[model samples]
Target chain A: MSGWTSVLVGDPRADRMVPKTGFTVQLTVFSSAAMAFLAVFALALSLATERLADRWSAELARTSTLRISAPQDQIAAQTEAALRVLQTTPGVGSARALSDDEQVALLEPWFGPDLPVASLPIPRLIEIVEIGDGFDATGLRARLQAEVPGAVLDDHTRWRAPLVAAADRLRSLGYISLALIGGAMAAMITLAAQAALSANSQVIRVMRLVGATDAFIAGAFVRRFTLRAFAGAGFGAAAGAAGIFFLPEADVAGGFLTGLGFEGLHWLWPLAIPPLAGTVAFVSTRTAAIRRLKEQS
Target chain B: MIELERVAYTYGGAELFADLSMTLAPGSFHFLTGPSGAGKTTLLKLCYGELIATSGMVRIFGQNTREMDRDQIALARRRIGVVHQDCQFLDHLPMAENVALPLTVSGRQEEADEYLADLLAWVGLSGQASQLPPQLSGGERQRAALARAVIMSPEVVIADEPTGNIDWEMSQRLLTLLVELNKMGKAVLIATHDLNLIRAAKTQVAARVLRLRGGQLQAAGSEL
Candidate 1:
């Protein structure tokens, strides 16, 4: 042991070793890069889910519904009276009874377009848009119950709760997926670093005997793995960006997955992945290298 | 200085040496002559704090090897230089780099240029300073190892078969360097099977020759 003055030792030249096992390096990089890429996508999904949930919940939060049903002649009369009542109520932004043509159009997707919507005894629909913090839906329902005797208030709580909960669940799932990807990247990089360290076992011996410290030896491997991870992550991120770029222009798929992709300056979020991968590799490789060195003595 | 008292070493629980006792003081030169598998290298390892004795005490610079932590051992090792038969080198690095490695690992890299030059010149390796370790001849490697060993200006220099793979002329050159270090007040311990080199060194320095054989250590001429 060149009498222990040096605390670091390893194949300092391993950086120039050019990696004879390119396939394994590639395999490891691809595995980590893919996970990171998926993580980027999951992060984007979570953010988008938040935005979507907020838009839907904010727009629908306090809105109530009015369904009027009576004899054809009385239906028009009751709908007019309900609109008048809502207009006079506090916190009601605007109340409009759906026209016969509008009601037919709403049903057109399910029923044939040629249906005579005016002749059917279908309930007259009135949409109540609320813009204030508080709404007296109970009072309005009571008024309609006693006066119109054919009107019911639907405050949208039943369907709105399930929709918001589903969106929240999706956002949570996205975050969980991102976390798992980070874990997998760490594991793969650790394995690759261990393999490289073992391959140069004799090199480590020479370095150790020459007075190189555990830190110096560990630093060389950490730099190598961190740089490799960065390179691979850059390539993967670029590929992901290009793939997302050629995605069908927003109008095509009607929504969901297409809108699920990034927009505007938000596209820059995935760029952090390469550096993140490098950090992961740096930490994992360091831990693994130090553990191996300790085991050697 | 190194002191061993009732020390024993084992690998896989097989004792290589038992209850060995010795002390090396400043400016003293000692030759450890032993048969094969006599644990000469192992004993040197204990002396340098590379290996801890399984039983009893092996102390260097007044600190027991068994009690020294890794960093403490490394700091202790700065005062001791060891040259091995294989002459381990970072083959990718130049001879100068390999020699300056001790300074580098100790974070004294700032003085590598000056000290490295002096070390290479002393070892007669000035010409091979820029060459990679693999490019050097076997004797050159041994010389480079010696250069690396002494570059830190150690108080004690230990060699495990420093002449095991060299010519007679190279062995003499190495022995001359070890004697010079001893004269400079550096304690020297060399383990070798070469009786010729031992006899050569015994004349120049007040060298005590000890032999390890059949799991027992004795003075060379005690049996005679």
Candidate 2:
């Protein structure tokens, strides 16, 4: 922090050599703010995808469902037999049959709330909770086949793998978006600094004539551009966070877009954007100033 | 405090001058007189380390300028004063700031206040301190440039055509200030084409006149 203050509080004597207000200043601030605003969405998307991957991996890996499709009189016996096989397995923690109302509610999104569970010839579903390493689905299926002949065990591997892969890919894209935003900000500030250096060529020559070091001349520009980026990014981060705050909450009706935001303590991440922008501005402007000065000299 | 030994300069496929040797010792006053395109300004630039000699050697304070980098040259310039022909300045700045620029660039802003008032008074520019460079007349701008040059109390003062744009009276006033600086034990080198200004300066100081012509530096023997 002290180092930051030292950079921010520059030598006023040298800084006064160049004019403070110009088109470059406005260009730097506006472009940095715009980039920071977009960065917020990228960050939200990344965090949301991460949460989705974790939920899918944890929920599907630790649980399985046993389905009994047999004759109406034989369905009760098959469900009991499947539950006995699951209880005897090494990794099985608890197994229970889902109630008709619970099963109907599971299908309610597609079939409506008034699903006729008793009249239809539907399979019975046994919810299996895994403890420790969880049961071996292949061995459990063989046991159920021999004992009840119509039961199947589903550990959700086939569906869970693809969903988790898609979520992971989306998270990577989010990170790539953030990198592009940072790169764009650096490039824009560098061009603006180059223009300012060209415009002040005479001033720089005079400064060199008067015994000003390259560091002294470059420091003025670096400090100004860095502060401008910091201020602009501060405003941008605040506005973006506020925009995210007003988004619709994630409910049963709402999907991924509604879930794309910070939750609880994750809200603090946006506060870092201003300093990050300032750092980017400092590096880019310093590089540009030094390179331009070398060419002029 | 500046030495040029057997120096030659060529530009645009033409040799401006060659085998030019001159030495400016402490408290010496010298005048460099030449016609237009005779490399008078170029010689002054070589004296101040602004231009490296194409051949031979130029040294400042006994250090060869050819061996010095830009940073070393800048540090050495703090000990020398240069007043350009056009009187260059940051036009956006006021006259006072322009005059005190040497101190400001050297990180001696605190020293500027103590010396600025007296320097401006001495140069007779105190009344025009708040005016911008564009607002000042030619003579006033030259005076401001001189003030900036001498604000550091350098060991050597080099001026290139300091009176080209001003009348005779203003030219004498500027000469008197340079003469005063010379009396304080500083080397003075002025490059100009005006013979009368050289005559005027000869009356006040024991000055040597050198002429650059036909690719050689020759001593002008009390002709004017």
Candidate 3:
């Protein structure tokens, strides 16, 4: 086109430090900016899932149950019998009936602090923690079913399986989202670069007439677009990182769902979004620029 | 050498020619003359590889135009130089850069520093090399265009309406330079409407005069 369009080297010599242009620089920048913003949430989601998984695994590792609900006169005797069985059982760490205060606290958020326990026949609650492979859940359940009648064993693995699987799926989904974002950034940058090239058709013809190769002409466009994308995404990422810093994170006693923000080593991961955006922009714009120039020839 | 066999070019459903043929040996000089809209510039473009013939064959240096890729066409173009009527240049660059463009594009910018300065001086615009194209007068621009065309020392030099925007004295000066290039073994093909300039060029060099009229090309009679 023109000398201005030829100033940027299309494909710089491998050993040379000269910068070259690629596919779609502006598109890359836009995609990077948008993706980087999304990537912050994905990364946070992944870290949160890992924590959720750990919490489920640790809390449910070795636990069983013994529920006792019988006739009002028989209730006291059955509770005592289940406690005696738990104390005598091998590998049992501890067995105790949950106190009224503990039960009230667990239900406080939903059912309020007060419960009409004397009017309604609420089943007695027991908590069991076991040591070293714990008591066999099936064996304990059979004994309680005969001796305590209303008693049931809960190893917690059934609920834990679904919870952990959901968390793991969320983590994988976050990674997939990050990949899609990167690809989208590349595609967007390429499109913007093509637009710029088309707009400068006269410049291209003049340059070609004067003997510049397609690579040289395309290089100029690629570099300009690449620089623009990198600079734009860098600004976007800085803003995103700053925004993440002020997000609300759940503290102690809150459910796993409330803790949806960055924690510990996870904070540093968001810092990499800017540079990753830049790399994607560079590659995408370069490819598009070269391809366009080749097609023009 | 350049050759055309029953060549024709069409644009926007308008026919410029149907059966035009011409040949130029090395070191030959020819003037293409026509009234306005006579396809003189179009014929010049065909002479170079800028526009391929719509039908028939146009060859440069014995290679068919159909066989040339962009790079091949560019390499072939390096052996030829073209000067447009408007003298297209990168307005952002100075006249020296403009004149040295052919060399620069050919990856021979290194040889331009001395040759370009000398060429600019020969064209009598040695003082204008550092100035931008827009800053130059019409006469000065024409001379710069001439310098740019010949800077590569190409085998063939094609000028389309080179002196159209300049005065008589300036036009004479440009013609003198073109004639000098012809003496240096460069085949010169100038497309113009000025018969007086053609008459003046014939005195300095043995030149052929061709006229494009009525969708056909013919050798002009020696009447001017």
Candidate 4:
């Protein structure tokens, strides 16, 4: 932090040694801002993906479905037997059979709502909500088979595995995108610093002849570039946050793409982008300036 | 004070000067003269620790320059003012700012106000203080460079062809300023091919003139 203060309130005399670089200043600021703006989206994506993965893992892991498929007259008897077994099982919080209307609503997207559910020999579904650690599917299956001959236990492993895996991959990709943005910012700033050093070779030689140390010379450049990055990234972060704020509400679409934004307190995360960009620029510019100054000496 | 003992310099497999030895004691005045490409500038550079000798030793203020790092060399330069032949200046800055550059670099910018005004007046550049280096004539620029070189009141002053671009009157004026600094106990070394300036300096102070020819330094005849 003290270093930041020094960079902001540098020795005015030292700053005078380096002339104002016109286009390089604009180039550094523009690129850093653009990178910071993109980084905000990457951060949002990573956070959103993480939230989705957690929801899928927690909701799916705790619940299972008991389906009874038997003759029309025996289905009710088997479903009743399955519920009785589930109630006595440890870790089973509650067991209730879904009504015909609820089942019809669930299948309305795949099948027409006007289907004759009563006339069809459809299987009965019993939703088993788990308590503490959730019931063991293997033990539950064995018990259901002995009690209700036509009952099947599904723990949702098949559905949850691929959804969670995809979410995890998306989260990792988001992080990689952030890393690439930071690396690109550093690379661009380094090149700009090198150009400024080369263009001001005469100033550097004169400074050296007048008894200025390499650190003093390098500080002038580092401070200028770091401040530019900070300001530019600040603007970029603001613009990015605004863009996210104005995005269509997640409830409007009820899709994954609509959820690709920051949640309540998560919005504070993008505020860090400016300082992080400033630090990157500071390190990159300092390294480049010192190396170039050493070479000249 | 500066000392060079058996100092040799080679650039691209070609020797500029070898076995060169000299010392500038306190309050001493010396002149280095040579024809074009005779290594006058190279010797000045060695005295100021700008270029390390290929062999032997060059010491400034009793410290061997070979052991000094870049920072140490910079600190040493603070005590040794140098005036190049071309009179380099930050072209964007005004004459007053350029003349106070040594003070500014040394973190003595506050002291610049008082001494800068007097130095500019001494160099007859008071009227051109606000003008940039590019706007100044050759004589004015040379004067400005001299003011900058002496802003720190360095113990030693090394000028390479200080009067190369100026007229006769301006050369004399620059020489008078160098003589005045020598009188004030500053070791002064001026490298020039102008024999008239060397003779003119001799009337003001006792100066040792050394000539460099065929890549060697030797005492010239007492022609002046």
Clashing pairs in 4: none
**Candidate 4 C-alpha lDDT tens digits along A91-121:** 9999999999988988889898887899988
Please compute and give the TM-score of the first chain of candidate 4 against the native first chain: 0.96
Per-residue CA lDDT of candidate 3, range B94-179, in tens? Answer: 78887887776666768987697688889999898789889999999999988888888889999999999999999999999999
Question: Each prediction's interface RMSD?
Answer: 3.6, 1.0, 5.5, 1.0
User: Candidate 3 overall Cα lDDT vs. reference?
Assistant: 0.78
Query: Candidate 4, residue B112: CA error in Å?
Result: 1.5
How would you encode candidate 2's per-residue C-alpha lDDT over B1-224 as one tens digit per residue? 79999999987889999988999999999999888889999999899888888999999999999999888889889989989889999988899998889898787899988999999999999999999999999999999999999999999999999999999999999999999999999999999988999999999999999998888889998686
Best-performing candidate as measured by lDDT? 4
Query: Per-residue alpha-carbon lDDT of model 1 for B1-224, expressed as tens digits?
Result: 79999988899878998988999999988899888888898989999888999998999999998888766777777778889999988776778878877777676777887787777888898899889988999999999999889888999999999999999999999999999999999999999999999888877888988888766777889331
**C-alpha lDDT (0 to 100) for residue B123 of candidate 3:** 96
TM-score against truth, every candidate: 0.91, 0.95, 0.80, 0.97
Query: For candidate 3 chain B, which ten residues in a row score worst on lDDT?
Result: B100-109
Candidate 3, A154: how far from true, in Å?
3.2
Which pairs clash in the backbone of model 2?
none
lDDT of 4: 0.91
Tell me what fraction of the real C-alpha contacts between chains A and B each candidate also makes.
Answer: 0.30, 0.68, 0.24, 0.80
Compared with the true structure, what per-residue lDDT tens digits does model 1 show for residues A1-297?
231111123344434322345354775678767876677778778877877788679877856778998888898889888888888888899889888888999899989898787777789889888976646888888888988888988888888888889889989999898788888899998988888888878777766665666776677667767777888888777777777777776578767677676778878978988888877887788899989989987
Candidate 4 at B70: error in angstroms?
0.6
Residue-by-residue lDDT tens digits, candidate 4, B72-128: 999999999899888989888888998888887777899998898888899999999
Looking at candidate 1 chain A, the ten consecutive residues that score lowest on lDDT are A1-10
